[model samples]
Target: MTSTLLSAIPRELDVGTRRSAAIAQFISTARQLIGDPSQASREDLEAVARHLETLGRQATLFPEEDFPVDQEHPAVVYRLSEEADGGFALYLSAALPGKSVLPHDHTTWAIISGVQGVERNVFYRRDKTADPARDALTPERTVDVGLGNSVILGPDDVHTIELQGHQTGLHLHFYGRGLDHMPARVVFESRAGGSYRTFGPPAGIRHARITPQDLKAALADGQEIALLDVRDAGVYARSHLLFAVSAPRWRLPLDIDRLVPRRNTRIVVIDGDESQAHDGAHQLIRLGWTNVSVLAGGTEAWAAAGLEVFSGTNVPSKAFGEVIEHEKQTPWITSEELERLVRQGDNIAVVDSRTPEEFAAFSLPFAHSVPGAELVYRIAEIAPDPETLVVVNCAGRTRSIVGAQTLIDAGIPNRVVSLRNGTMDWLLTGRTLAHGRQTPLPEPSAGHLAGARAQADAVAHRAGVRRIDAATLQRWQESARQQQRTLYLFDIRTRAEYEAGHLEGWRWAPGGQLVQATDEYAATRGARIVLADWDGVRALTTGAWLAQLGWDVSVHAPATHGPGAARVTGPEPVRVLVPDSPAPLIAPAQAAALQQSGAAVLIDIDSRAAYEKRHPAGARFVAPGRLSEFIPTLPAQASVVLISADGILAHSVASGLLRSAKPAQPLLALRGGTRGWIAAELPTDSGGDGVVTGDDDQSYSPYLQKDLALRNAGFVEYLEWELGLVAQLEREGHTGIALID
Candidate 1:
């Protein structure tokens, strides 16, 4: 390897093809092993974290329009790419003056390391008793809490911090998978009925693109030095300099704290022909990208110099199947085991980290309703035996493991093992379930909160998990559509019920590979995913797992009412009411029906998607990363329309779609869509057929640069790099990175 001033470089060239990089094979093998977004082996994730650890060239920063903000210290951001499971992984931040946000939470766990300034953290929880809808933004005041002033957020704990507003704040954040992939990310809206209305599921999140302008130039008179491009393979191939090789953007995160090896290394970013590579050059110079000078025009100028180039290759990310072949540990414990452990006088403290109700109706023998928030302080009073094995169990493992790991990391002197297979495992073993509520240990203290926070480090622990309620499963059975949002319900329960009583469409997703395998259900970025664990809690947390991805999400919190245990929630299955009736189809029948229902969803069925591949008129792709958020703006009673595909696929995918979108009227397919009108032929024109239509504002992704020509490079440079980072800080927050200035 050639030496350079930029230090902390990763060892070895991580080489692998796109095909070889797949957990199994992206399509064929991953298809069999993968479940929903909610399930992926922790080991697989750890491995991904490791693979991502590899070093790459200093990534090129691009120039793009700023997010509109009235505040001088506007919290601005630019996003990069996302992680494998589904969380916003790459993005930078800038702070705002006053209040940063309305108290909210990111879908999954995250790491908010300070890349710039000092920040104050504030946390909020939904007032369970308040009407979800009547809960206006200013309706409730915030709980100002102190968590030791700092500008860092580790991977697991959720936090909201205020930027003192002195300078621009920058934070490097890490998420579950990729930013756009978050599940059940409904924008909170108040309905007249005083309930929160959810929107559509995330359809397609935008991918980043890098264009010539994104590159910064640090020219030294004539430029007789070396150039280093630290972007990803996709960006490199779309267009790059012949001499430039791929050094990933990961360099800053993994290596920088260490060293930059040499001096005099004139590192120049080859991020195409445009933007000044100064930010990267600035970063490197700070890290000693000595004599660093960005190529005059980046790779574009170089390539335009008729330099050689490379494309169609892939950089190695983490290996996916690390846990697929291994036996997965059940995320929870069985009732009988809890009984036996309690009965045997074992020093085991079984903490039930479920909601209060779940703890009440039916619980493991002697497990206490420790509830996730109360796990910390109640530990000693509940368990007392520090040396004893502290077993944490939820219906399944996602939360239990997280809860238990919480203990482990806090240095709690107990062996924390999630019940291998949880309650389902016990039942599968023919153990009659025991039910009873265990009293709370106490109100908990600061020590408990601290301990809980410590354990939160494992929050990023992506356990192989998935879930769905019986009602949700039944609903999927009815009016199932063709392709739009198909939910391949995988019943992890026994084959008998699956064969005998399981909802009609559900397929069996046994407990085994469901961990290592993540592509099974909800494989398409656009498809809604649902997992059913007849075993209850398993589905809720599993759904929580998916919800973390910001994809629309909800679990069947099934009613205690037996047999048909799962009730198909009717009415607005997934509602979307457009702010205004732009599309043609506000028919009297549709209008009257919409007005009558509790959840009338009004969307331009002809809005987004179907037309991307050249469709008739009336359907356009939902703006990337926004299918579900806007859905809530519509009337809840009506069906979210999909005028594309003539409406078939949308209806089919509705059930699964609702999994992420939450409750909504079943999707209503607009027959013939806009095409039907043009054909039966009504008047229609282009909403944009996947092409870069115009800068008239109506025809663009907010994240996309208005003038971007090269789609791939442009996205990376403008959207992800420029706009993404700004938006990110708004989500995870920024309190620390400001000092770097």
Candidate 2:
């Protein structure tokens, strides 16, 4: 019967010419057979699977290059429809070899048909004898899905997939309802003592994609949505859909908490490829985001649909900065004028409010690094003479505007102005940048300190910021713990100052940048926030903005612990406890001896760039995600030693390797990772030649390109991107954001 179905296809027809039509026909037939996919029966799904198999065989007729898999992400999903609510969904999926997915059950009935390479499907059955709350899965059967083969899984089915062979595998899948909208799906894991635990589904599933027309309608109707461009800043700077914020794919996980604190907010992710959008949607879903979707076909599709696109990074913030400048008429000085004043030995003080690293990279002449948060605290020392003019600058306008305005709000006696357009404008006007300077602020006098405190109190009062005592803060902390609410206690000070001495539970965030990039620090919209500093100036200045931003904010006036009390140096260490392993851990010296004996194979799991900069001699760089692909290539009998920047990542990777079905060799983690090796005076090597597997996790940014022309173009485009944000925000109806006067 299957042979008869295969013979029906035109023998001489070109695959490329007939592919889309064939897939469309299959979709049409599947819809007819399984109308109202949510109500599809087991037999109805199986028939659809069989039809998919017939169509899958024709996959060879199409060009393989068209369905390429992303190495980093490993899978590419070609969405065929946008129906996400109890509606049918068709997707073409392609994955590279050696990919192993964890066991999971689709909340809806699913059918898969293989087109290329081989896929090993392992099926599991739920053990009814186990407690209802604790799921137990027992492996039942394994099926090798080859070209023309098909498999149908009921809603309750559980399975894991392993891509076989050394080639990419392609498959066509149809689901009863979209997988992205099914948050009740289960991921089963084997626990100790023959038990199984079913991990809860992600926060929420997002719709797969949104058409440009639909998005336009939503905007026109004033719907609330966060259009996020999950591409590199350089790519985003080049061109992107209107109102789309630049949130790089790699950094999205880290930044999403702060960027989209309201979990229920509708988020639409845009990217050039379906894989990035699909992966981004899944990531947000895992993080418990309730409403998310990918922009169908990305910017190209939007452009094709005759929609406007823009370029740049942080456009909204930049546009708001411009608005503030225009409305408030913020004081400003041209770089050339400032340079002339400095040359004339004028009584002016220049302060760079950027991070220490950025200030060190480049700054105006005689500028001191007093990061935004430290501006109020150290301003007395920076411009002690009330007659001295104070000029603040950053890499661009936002920080400069905010910092200069902050000083003004505090009623600083000195004449203050922002360097208009900041360093970018300075460079455009042919001014030179001073590099690698470390000028520190002068010590503050008693009178200067007293004046700053008084100014801060006034500003905080006007902003309606509250002052909290230690007892009140403790009550809030206890409430947060009991209610599962977020409470952030931040020390608004310089990194050096915070490292020297800070309250035990408080994390350090520079006041200026914290306000500028609030999404990076606070992920909960209504969370209580407390700002602390040695003197009250920095805390009050930072707290005032937080209050205006709608945060439940308070300033801790008196120091909880005076300088050096409850102190800890450096950032907190990340510790992930894995199951105890029998493999022995070797110190740097011991590993060196083992390497000399030709028994040690070191795998460095740090970032590719970090590995190339310096890695222990003979260490091969491999990303943790691609460890499965690299494992088979390692020497069969060599003892493997995993090393990351720290031992935490190495321990996790080693644990994963131990859990694999076919463990090749004994795996161990370096006691302290590469840092320990360096501390032990071990030799290191540099360069990409040491990379054994592909480095797909790190993406190349055009802004960071070595080509001077490309770099300059990126900067120019970035400014244009920023300029259009305000208009886009207005058009998109983003009511959640506000620009304070």
Candidate 3:
């Protein structure tokens, strides 16, 4: 691997004076340290030990001794100095543990070099219900790696490093001039446990000499930038922007979660004083946030820049407000019940109906994005099971609440509920979020036509229809071919037309665009749709697409239409009645109650976490993959099992295990998942470490590459940043290699 090791330590710093004879002295003493690093003398290692000991505070790690003592974990660390490069910059860092982190971005490009040892980087999505960063601004994202050879970092990237192999290490983190202005950090999250956090400009990072008037041109450029007010709430209440989120320098954490959750967006912090905004941005940069430039003069500068301001009074209603109110509130699945469904592999569709931008910003890690406005427009992209439950959400109450009700109002066959209080409530409760946007989805869940599909059973099914090698699917296709049926198979989703692999002879008539282009694919307006998708969303969207095209259609589940859409006009509802069996599916809650009295045994059909997260406290982690082995271990006295998991496959596996041993224990499928239990606020814990061994699950990455990417808009600045990071990683002893890209 190509490495960009720290190549220079100049004799004279850019300050036009020799801050110290350190670099020259280092050149003279380099051989002793590198040749026999284990035998380096105290005097020779003085410079290296100074930073760790003092840390700008005459107390810590080595406070009792002449040098810093070995510390397993500590607080903030000063990473780099401006003298290291010509352009204004510095580096700082902190240690993270306990899996308590949120994926986020930085304020500018930084040189993050590892020290002492290697660390593992894990990215996560912000779970709104658990975005600790809203209060503490945690960083989270889906996993992404640029280079494998270096323990170095670059601009706009956020990650958490756990000292790998040796258990502990250090990092010489670096930040460019622009990053010195952040005031706070923000993270986005969802109830399903996904998150995305962003570091924002602080009140301190603003250029002291620049003025608000200097930013007028950039703002006038139209959507090129944002002016964030970081004054106290009272000050902002007195006067602020129609576009701003009452962002006081002290409130950057709170406001960022509600306003800007993505690092790609450009924002400038403003306050009564420019220093606050500048420092705000500076702090944000140290946290790995980028894309911010503080207001030169705060509010005064905005006025000087000739920008418009508005007096208070546009805040939306909070719960019981006059502007908006909740209608009939629907109950959501509990964590236990959700777990039950997960194990059973029951059809379930969890949707984050926020804006796509918002969804990208943060949402449930396992859930798919179904932008609110796009709900009715994309129902067909969800699951095809008529019994599947669909949950929707927005940032807070309004959209999520409204979206859920809208689905019920439509004829969606599936149960639909809104994430309680949306992401805002999720964060308030201190739950964790996942950052899944980092990787492309193996299966598409939410799409435009998907919403429409939710309204009609046949249409919805067709919309999200996928042709597996199942006998039923093959039989259907064979029947169609023998009958000379012209099955109009439409892939009603956008994105790529089956990036993974699609069935042959499939036509792409994305539901979102089909509303306007149906005529091109309609072919006499009598074509029967054979919608397709990885998750059956295409079928639902197709029905909606047909409705918009004026054709009556059918869909999966029920929530497929609004007040007016399509009408089911073809076949009559077929009601097939079977003879009553000895026993039927049992409720997970009932099972839990029984277990409390030794009346039953709770069985988990998912990963240990899915069950142990909040299932019946005594539930068994009888995973589907380990059914044969687990079956022998179960107690014969337990007669009933509340089978639980994320989907139906596990349920089937559990049922098979029972069959192999003379079908003694009756199994009841959990309707939802662990969500059903947790919704009840039932007791739970971090038990049951799940093991995955299939090809679908990865065990390890042979080569874990830690890398950084800098926007080369200014090559010189980018190189400086790159070099700075090289030094930081080198100091920490990370095996970092660099590539320009």
Against the hidden reference, what TM-scores do the models get?
Answer: 0.25, 0.58, 0.23
- Any runs in candidate 3 off by more than 4 Å, and if so which? 1-217, 220-226, 251-265, 273-275, 304-306, 312-741
**Model 2 TM-score (2 dp):** 0.58
In angstroms, the error of model 2 at 334 is 3.1
Give the alpha carbon lDDT tens digit for every residue of 124-234 in model 2.
Answer: 877654566565667888988878788888888888888999988877777876654565776755421133444542322223456788777654443234677776554
Shift of residue 582 alpha carbon in model 3, Å: 62
Model number with the top TM-score: 2
Q: Model 3: how far is 474 from its true place, Å?
A: 31
Query: All models: lDDT?
Result: 0.39, 0.69, 0.41
1-741: candidate 1 lDDT, tens digit per residue: 111322322232111111112211212222233333246455444433332222111211112222122364266554433322232344444454453542334565443444344455554334433653443332322222112111222233234456654544544344544444544443333211123443432222211122333222212122222345554333444555423444333233223221222223234455555342533443343332233434555665655654344332210000111111022332345556666777789777777766655666566666677654345445766765677778877654445654564455345666776665455444445554565554744643566545543443333233322335555556654523421123445454333334555544345543222321233222222234466534333343333334343233333333456665543422212222121112223342453355356344323322332344344333334431244555565555555654443443333334333533454544554554444534553434444553221221122322223332443343333222321322332332211111000
Better by TM-score, candidate 2 or 1: 2
lDDT of 3 by residue, 1-741 (tens): 001111232322211011112212322233333234334444534433333222222112111111111344342343222321112343334333322333445544433344333445654333234444342234454232111222223333455545444323344343433343333444435323354445553322122122455454444332323456655444554555433444444323323432443332345566665545654554344333344555545666565556654433222111111111222545454434544565687787777755445566667665677644345544545656767788775554545654565465455667787665555445434444565463233332454345454454443343333333334445555654652222454445443434333444455554533432333343222224555543444345435434432343432221234532233332222221111121245555665676788767666654443443455566656434334445455566665564544424334333434422344455555545455665655555555543322211111111111121221222233223322432333332211111110
Please give the TM-score that candidate 1 achieves against the real structure: 0.25
Q: Candidate 2 regions off by >4 Å? A: 1-323, 425-431, 548-550, 558-613, 616-643, 650-671, 685-711
Candidate 3 TM-score, true structure as reference? 0.23
